[model samples]
Target: MRKIKAQLFISLDGVVEAPDQWHFPYFNDEMGAAVDATLGQADTLLLGRRTYDSFAGAWPGREAAGGEDAPFAKVLGDARKIVVSNRRLDFTWRNSEQADGGPAEAAAALRAEPDTGAPVWISGSVSVVRHLLAAGLLDELNLLVHPIAVRKGMRLFEEADASVPLELLSCETFRTGVLNLFYAPAAGPGAGTYEDAKTHLPQH
Candidate 1:
């Protein structure tokens, strides 16, 4: 099966909303380069309805204008995108498709694709992430935790029936106080540490 890699920009308080507000200011050249490098590893993109609307609105135009000439716009225009949305509408972007069902269905459809050896990147999809987590469809998670805390905003992880354990594969802190953390599901029962316990550790 192909791996599903979920990446997010979250605040210290676990807020993942609108990172452009508090997080973008700290995005230095090194961080930009790193993000570009990370994007290069994936050829598939997955997104929730809200996030899909946001990205579809911005990227298609920017990509057409060849604006920024950055890795994000470039790859976004080229990669295959699967947007999960119940809303009735057709996908306008080339190489993009609208998934009419929920996360589990979308994940299953994605897994059924022919082996491409490229990862499917889930970006800015908290609801989709939660559903995939519950369905055991997520293979890996890469969270970029910014230092600032927002008093009120959307959260990265909300309460579920029970806690799902994940093993910390690696972590690192950038000079801008952004911490990059990677995680995968625990191999067995009682096989993983809490997220809070690994907060201060440097990335591997």
Candidate 2:
């Protein structure tokens, strides 16, 4: 089955909204390379309605301009996109589809359709991601935690779902002070290391 790799640009306080306003000061060539690498790794993009609309509106125009961003724009424009939305989505973008259902069910059904090996990349779709996390449909999460705290934006996990345990896969600190934390869902039960520690201690 194909894995769902969810990526987010988050602040120190866990805010995941409007990164374009604060994310650029910390963006560097290193981070750009990482982002580009991620885009190259995915053949499919999973998005929420808002994100799908935003990208579909902007990236196509960017691709048409044939500028420095044109290559990435073309990549995004050509990739298969699955948008989760209850609203009717008459998508004009190429290779786009809509799932008028719950996020988990839609994502699981997508992943189960043969082994593509390439991951399904989900970026900037927090609500859908939360649902996927709750349903254990997400295979990996990549969070670019910036040093600044917006303090008052939409949070990534604002009681939107139950707590989901994650196992750290990798951590990289960029030159611009951004922390890239990669994680996957913890496998099996009893994942907590300090559970019932009193019983494991010496019975003195």
Candidate 3:
């Protein structure tokens, strides 16, 4: 079955919103390469309605401009896009369609399909990522953690959500202070460690 790889550009303080405003300032060749490494293998995209609308609106025009971004624009424009939305979605973008159901159902169905070795990518779709992460359906999570702390903004996980333990796959720090962290849900529990003791304390 094809795996799901979710990518997010997040701040040290866990903000995931409006990456366009704060993201580009720190972007460099290193960061660009890291992004490309993920985008390169993917033939399909899993997007939230907002993200789908944004990409459909901008990328086609960018592709036509024949500029530096045109290559990536063309990549996105040509790839299959699966959009998740509750409301009616009359997509104008080519090869776009609504997901089968909610995030988990849609992702589960996608994963059940015959493996062609291509990945389904999640791009700037926090809600969909959260649902999949909570449901234990996400295969890999790639976070480009920036150094800055944007104290206030939308976050991927809220305080109300329970903790999800992850096993780190790889960690690389770029020259620009960005950290490319790759993680997957842990296979199983490990022997209790010192940190586990803290949770045993009686409630106050």
**Residues 1-204, candidate 3, lDDT per residue (tens digit)?**
889989999999999999988899889999988878877556899999988888899989988999998888878878888999998789777788899889999899889888877888998899999999899999999999999998889998888646788899999999989999999998557568877988898879
User: Least accurate stretch of 10 residues (summed lDDT) in model 2?
Assistant: 187-196
Off by over 4 Å in 2: 187-204
**Which predicted model would earn the best lDDT?**
3
Q: What lDDT does candidate 3 reach at residue 197?
A: 88
Clashing pairs in 2: none
The residue-by-residue lDDT of candidate 2 on 28-61, one tens digit each, is 9988988987875668999999999889989999
Q: Residue 47 in model 1: shift from native, Å?
A: 1.0
> Whose TM-score is higher: candidate 1's or candidate 2's?
2
All candidates: TM-score = 0.86, 0.90, 0.91
lDDT order of candidates, top first: 3, 2, 1
Q: How does model 3 fare in lDDT?
A: 0.89
Clash count of each predicted structure? 3, 0, 0
Candidate 3 Cα outliers beyond 4 Å, as residue runs: 187-204
Output the worst ten-in-a-row residue range by lDDT, candidate 3: 186-195
TM-score quality measure for candidate 3: 0.91
The predicted structure with the larger lDDT, 1 or 3, is 3
